[model samples]
Target: IIIGEKRLRQQSKDPRTPPSHQPEADITPSPSPRPRPPDNLEEGEVEEVCEISTPPSEVLVVEGQADEPFSTDHAQRLIGQIMVWNGQIDRMRDQIDSMRKRLDTMQQEIKNMIDVLGRI
Candidate 1:
């Protein structure tokens, strides 16, 4: 980001100058990165599966013609969702509490059985 800012400042210093007059250091092309070869291939072998391209872009909204994207109904729906999620959380807590009680009962039964076997 700092390098880009420096380039922008350097360019703005002489905005009217032609590209040919610019210093060679700033105009040099950056190195293209090489993709690694697959392990199955022989040594020094490589394969390019795809090429990078610019992504497509489009305007999502136009001047004065854009419709209102929000409503009171959407807000109400969000509140309703919160209530539904809260109910689900309550149900999960109840189920977990019941499961803990069952586990405790099973543990007590196992201890009793062990005690009976020792007595016999």
Candidate 2:
């Protein structure tokens, strides 16, 4: 009888049972609590899983388009883009000026040829 009573008590204390599958039994402390679905838990009774809080970003927020809050990196990126555009525009202007000068030279040569032909 004594041996049988001891066996029953050992079984009860063994954590392999249904309700004792807790992470605490594993003995390593988790940085964050595990999350669980809210069911029959009392309003004030906090579960071990629900005790940890998550970061603000992890919490859900509704969609709304606020003016894009610009950061320094974004501003720097914008400035870089503007500089690239300005360089391209300056290159195009230089090309157009070169083309205009060539056209003017060609026109003067044609006028000189016409005058020489008239003299001939």
Candidate 3:
């Protein structure tokens, strides 16, 4: 919840500014290249890539999940679980949309307040 609140604070800092008004640099993602070692490194020393481009090349997991022998009961349970997860995802999406609308309304109100103040 703390992390989420921090993200919300950062997002609302400039809620009055629409995405289109934001600079291209701020909207675009920055490239992440592996960092290079300094030239002052010792002659025999070697520097590894500071960035992890990919996870371990391969992961061998024995019996990652023991699959139960095919059974109608298992299939039904799996389907029910999937349905539950889908419903949860849909609810979260709806909540996010609702929050975005509220944010937009607040931004509009702020803009109106500024306009009214300007007229004074």
- How many residue pairs collide in each prediction? 0, 0, 0
86-112: candidate 1 lDDT, tens digit per residue: 999999999999999999999999999
**Most TM-score-accurate candidate:** 3
Deviation in angstroms for 67 in model 3? 6.0
lDDT of each: 0.55, 0.55, 0.55
Better of 1 and 3 by TM-score: 3
The 10 consecutive residues of candidate 1 with the worst lDDT sum are: 1-10
Off by over 4 Å in 1: 1-68
Model 2 lDDT vs. the true structure?
Answer: 0.55
lDDT for model 1 comes to 0.55
Model 3 misplaced stretches (Cα beyond 4 Å): 1-62
Each model's TM-score? 0.42, 0.42, 0.43
User: What TM-score does prediction 3 earn?
Assistant: 0.43
Across 12-63, the per-residue lDDT of candidate 2 in tens digits comes to 2334543222122122355455446478888788555423333432312223
Model 3 lDDT per residue over 1-120, tens place: 011111111222354653232222212222454355678989788665333232332222223344233468977999999999999999999999999999999999999999999999
